[model samples]
Target: MVSLPEELQAREAAARQRVEELQAEAAELAVRLERARAALSRLEITRETVMEVLADLSAAEVEAHDAPDPRETPAPHGIGVMAVPPWREGLVAGVLPDVYRDIVEIVADAPGPLQAKQIVPRIGLEATTAKIEGTRGKLKRLVERGWLDEDTPGRFTLARHEGDAGHVNSR
Candidate 1:
């Protein structure tokens, strides 16, 4: 039979051991969390670098190509290679790639400004964080190119060009 003092000592030891185990588990989880954060940072950097490279390539391609006849309707740009062009008179959303055209059409059709998260599902993409961020980038690019307006930060709407109220819908 164990004495009361021995039983208390044993219980204390077990509790200490359990605390140590919990500490070890917490340390491991912290390490894993740090690794995941680093990986996410690296992926974001890689994505930005790729987008820059693609934009540069698109610009080079546009410069190298011979100018098309002004009288002829321009062909729709290919997917994954086209840069958002600056909006101009007679420039319609049809000349943009499918994703960009859809974005423009969605904004144009919306009653008011829309957030990137709201646009994500409408663009047929899952409303994940990555997709929302990517869509936000595209929306920012459109605003830069004069295709869209960011009246309030993070909210987007079609750019209102004089005499081109129906241009976005022309696509």
Candidate 2:
């Protein structure tokens, strides 16, 4: 026959052991939860970085698609031989590319003839040698296409036709 006090002591020891086991399990579960949270944070960062890179790539593709290739061969009949088309009576500056249109507008609005260095800054470009040279090339192309004139060397102005007035308007 077991005594009542002895039975009570035995039950108390079992309960203490169960409590210790439960506490150990809880500590291990907490570590696992922290590790999972850290992994989720890392994954979120990686996903955001990938999305940014993809967006940049998409923008670059659009720009490349919109920009005309300078080295492309001309089609028959001189239809597509040049990027800067020859100016006609009804032709407007809007027919040109974004950079070309901006250049024409700047030249048209200038009080006097402009040089490549003078035009570069007005077109929101940095005043670097490469930028100046590129602008010079565009200016020469415009001159050749009859959109502009080079009355003096390295100076550009809007071309004047016999009956075409207000050909280039500010937009």
Q: Report the number of the highest-lDDT candidate.
A: 1
Checking candidate 1 for backbone clashes, the offending pairs are: none
What are the Cα lDDT values of the candidates? 0.85, 0.81
Q: What value of lDDT does candidate 1 attain over all alpha carbons?
A: 0.85
Model 1 lDDT-worst window of ten? 69-78
Q: lDDT tens digits, residues 1-171, model 2?
A: 999999999999999999999999999999999999999999999889877875675467456745444234221233222456567555677767778889999998899999999999999999999999999999999998789999999999999988777768622
Count of steric clashes across candidates, in order = 0, 0
Off by over 4 Å in 1: 1-82
TM agreement with the true structure for every prediction:
0.57, 0.52
Worst 10 residues of 2 by lDDT: 72-81
Q: For candidate 1, lDDT tens digit of each residue in 24-106?
A: 99999999999999999999998898899888976775576466532245444555544566676777887776788899999
The alpha-carbon RMSD values of the candidates against the true structure, listed in the order shown, are 6.9, 16.6
